[model samples]
Target: MAADDGVVLDEGAVVLEDAPPSNLDKLENSPPSNLDKFLKRFRALNPHFVRDDAEKLVCFFGDSDISHWKELPRVRITGDEGASWARCVNVGVGGAEMLHVAFYSAECRAKYRPDVVVLCAGENDLGAGAAPPTVFSYLEKSIAAFGHLDDATEQAQLRLRHDPQRTRDNANVVSSLPIDDTKSQQQDGMNASEFSRLRNNNTDEKVPIVYLCTKPEPVADAELRREYERYDGRIKELFQRYNSSCQEELLYFIDNSDLRDPSLYAQDGLHLSRQGYQVWDARVRDAVERVLLKMDERVLAP
Candidate 1:
């Protein structure tokens, strides 16, 4: 059965009968051992803290969910064994679109001077009924802004010339636009091929990475399920174009679309659950590690 809020419920509460148990649950249920207490204290004192000797600085720019996720990417990366050497700065603004994200990223870059920028926005733009060109243009502008390219002059010219190389050199990693089950119509505003063209046309040197987080399957609402079925193929096609066009070194695609497990999602069915964010955290951490390793190699080559 479903709740008045449209959340699927089994008996009295929302439950995940078919999903595997999450590690978070184990941590929650187990008594706090000495080591667990120590770790908990350490995390409480400095949840988003990075060591002074950290190798790289990562900045995240995205929507409200990115800002408020149970574990922000920065905190997750800081705690990761492989990625602990990196520092993180999160500048995610709730309810932001590509345009707002670009502006904030530019501001954050000036202050933090991050070596890597991860973008997890654009859904709001689609929700707002923006056209494909409009959405793409905002993305381009945001990329340029974060790269420290002069916005007023460069953004105008970029639309005409559309230099993909400039963006590629900026050390930006953009997450692909995910499919939202709630939206009946296409949220991306553009078709897959056109989106592909816009993205490919702007590339050149291939240093920046594109991370694709696939949408979840099995939306509970029948109406929403129908909507997802209609758009899922096109979303997959867009992701394919992004992955196929880029060198393996420059693209990191996380295919969660086949994930039908309701436990991975929040009550809304649109956002990710704590477990889902954990999945994202691991993938993004790996991608950032690869980028940092490649960068280190480049620096040491000379």
Candidate 2:
């Protein structure tokens, strides 16, 4: 009936002029025609930041799947007992991997300084046909980068406390450190020590890291499904490795792989419907409760 630009179309590639701009905008904005807009809307539903009524902060970071995280209406809060957090920011971007997370972490903490971050990634890494160790290696680097920032912040804070005037003079330089960049794209400059400090703080009281295993994915049997499955197994293995390296009380993992109901997915066997999102919402809440338990143990243990 109409060409994409709102010009009327006749059968043989002929287009009629005089189409209204109003009509043109609608056609141009159509979901199929404007994938960027659709993706933006989809990602926006997952806010990257939300004010926390409770003192503690929580956030989600990863790729598209995490971008859709806020679609889950409710979130579970630990330590508060009866309290709950509304929602935090969703920083997921399309095709983001652990390297992206590592890079973004340097950016995110510099900006928001959220106390808790919920990550749902590895999907993109696995989907890209990465080997297990290769993906985990990147993830390891990313985690280290996160700790690196924590170390910098701690050192800066300590220096400020020791000599407020001296710190004031040097604050610019300290803040200018590459770890302070919140712009996501600027973290490529981090070096090895910068990376190791991120993991070194595993048991540090100030900056505790929580890594959630990826959610369960549908077995779509697409051309890339087997490849995806291989990566999925790798993800679990990484979690196991991280958990084993430390006492369970220090580093904990909650398995929400089966949280979303199989029925909630779209027929394509890959994304989710609104109902499916609700299931994920519930899963994250439960997982948070578990994470809180671990945190409490770490804090309360003698």
Q: Name the best candidate (by TM-score).
A: 2
lDDT of 1 by residue, 110-170 (tens): 5556666666655444444333334444454555554322323324211212123422211
lDDT of each: 0.45, 0.45
lDDT, model 1: 0.45
- Candidate 2 C-alpha RMSD relative to the actual structure: 16.8
Per-residue lDDT of model 2, residues 73-143, tens digit only? 45556554666554456666644555345445555655556655666556454444444334444454445
Over the full model, what C-alpha lDDT does candidate 2 score relative to the true structure? 0.45
Give the residue spans of candidate 1 off by over 4 A: 1-54, 73-84, 148-256
Evaluate model 2: give its TM-score: 0.55
| lDDT for residue 298 in candidate 2, whole number 0-100 | 67
